[model samples]
Target: MSQRKVTMQVIADTVGVSKYVVSKTLNNKLGVSEATRQKILFTAKQLGYSKDGPSEGPSLPLETEIENGYILVVLPNYEYQSISYTYWGAVFQGISLHIQSKKAGMIVITSEMDLSKKVDVPNLIGIITVGTVDEQTLLALSTYNLPIVTLDHEARIIRADSIFMDNLGGIERMTDHLIGLGHKQLLFVGNIHYSQSFYERWIGFRNSLEKADIPLTQGNQKILTIPYDDNMEANLQQHFEELRIHSTDFPTAFVCANDHIARRMIVLLEQNGLACPTDISVTGFDSLEEDKHLSPALTTVQVLKQVMGRRAVDRLVWRAKNRDYPSEKILIVGDITFNESIDAPKKR
Candidate 1:
């Protein structure tokens, strides 16, 4: 007895279906019921049909052509908010441009997805991440063994390439600018997360205050760890009132984490019958979109967001092509944009 050769028609006949149905089922295409699809697949396998063959399995190439390479871009947040859009837009543009120049493509992903669930995507040559990732997530990315480049967040200590803005320098510049305007009692407002950027900014704020011989007293500093959302206005207002009550004297200035916070603080101050630059001067980091349009244009440190984007892509691609490349920390400096929000401290 000789073994009968197995074919789609044979499988269809065995499963009591048309050859077209078996073909569609094997190709994993639409139109086949789940039960029918499973029956067709099981029968074909039992009959000694090679499931790994091109006709039976997925048709993706074993290795994507080098000329048509693809990379993955990851962002920290799911939605566009704050200055994230600006940074994301510039970084994505840089990655897309670079990929297009090399006749390749990029697939952008957000870390907002629950990592416990599985994701389906092609093998990526490299990754460009925009924010700090937790250790578990970092381990998962390391499992891929692909070169990653981070922007705005520190990537040096981790097993990845990085391009970050000189956040400490920017904060220092902003604080110094306030000091120059005769702001002795300055308040630094920001979250105290260990993420590199935030940590650096906090360090800069402390160092600037210490250099000026100003004590880091509770009355002169506040750290808000709460989420900025619908109730943010109320929360901030309450926090501000508490600060005012505690302080022996009102701080002459406030250095905020970013422009959004500064804007909110301004509004809250006005509501409480306090005015900026007259009652207290204010400065912000990450020159945001609405900064210039505010009643008093914000004085802020403009991070080289677009430049950071381009550098991140260039470095990631370079590392992807050559694995032995030494990782580097590229820090772009930001400049202060002076505006009406800052002025000499008011007379006591």
Candidate 2:
């Protein structure tokens, strides 16, 4: 008996791509997108395809372009996350600056591109992802066998180096600050399950309250976990109205998950005939610059977004050189910016 021959057709069929694509990809030429090229390469390797002959067995990409010194950066397709967004933009700027200093190339792409299209590039050293990427996308990336470092993301199913802010500690400090300012009746805003970071922030807030023996009543937890959508502002306003209608002991401060939600909370409080700080104080995380222009600057935690990007690049380079090392999670500590948004609870 003899073993079957492994050809481009076999790889193409296995990968569900056309033979032309397989040929272009195997030859390391243009005409195929990064995703398609990766798929074809993985399939060829799995099927034991050899360019020389069957006797030589499987042969993978030459990888000679590793000397090209290029790094691939992947971003999720969410509208709220991009290179231009305040937080993400700062992180990308850091990645860009560090890559330039190291004299390396960076290629950025979103997860929602047409996988069959053309995207020419040299063989990459590794991948660094920003924001929360879907598990399926991460699994697809793993096929390339390149080291991956994720910034502000943690995947349960895939093993990769991850870097994010000290979400838990940041929120805990903020909550302590509000409590010190004499705020007892407190509410936490933002969807707790929106992301791992958000959930950690909620936990930190709760931890501080528990230490002080501040009972978490049903009303305090009512609007904390509502998911954001097109009508988030309206929905938040409605919740506020309901709180006023039912209870005279309304919350005196709101610990928001992020700066955006904190700003929104301030506005909603004003519309509900409550003055921020004077009537109720609000605190937030991610001390974004856009919030500085607000009447009372948001009291929030300052996340090192750009520093997180630079650290992620450092981790990816380290992983590329030390492939066998265990994956590590790097946490960057954030500082609290004491601003005017928080004040002592008004006398009843």
Each model's TM-score, in the order given? Answer: 0.72, 0.76
Clashes per candidate (backbone, < 3 Å) = 0, 0
Q: Give the local distance difference test score of model 2.
A: 0.80
lDDT of 1 by residue, 125-226 (tens): 777787776666666666667888877665544688778778888898788767877888777766656357777887888788788787776654534543
Error of 1 at 151 (Å): 2.0
Q: What is the C-alpha RMSD of each candidate to the true structure, in Å?
A: 17.3, 12.3
Clashing residue pairs in candidate 2 (N, C-alpha, C atoms within 3 angstroms): none
The digit string of per-residue lDDT tens for model 2 on 163-258 reads 989998998888888888888888888887788899889889899998888987764462456666667788787777766723557888889999
Worst 10 residues of 2 by lDDT: 58-67
lDDT of each: 0.72, 0.80
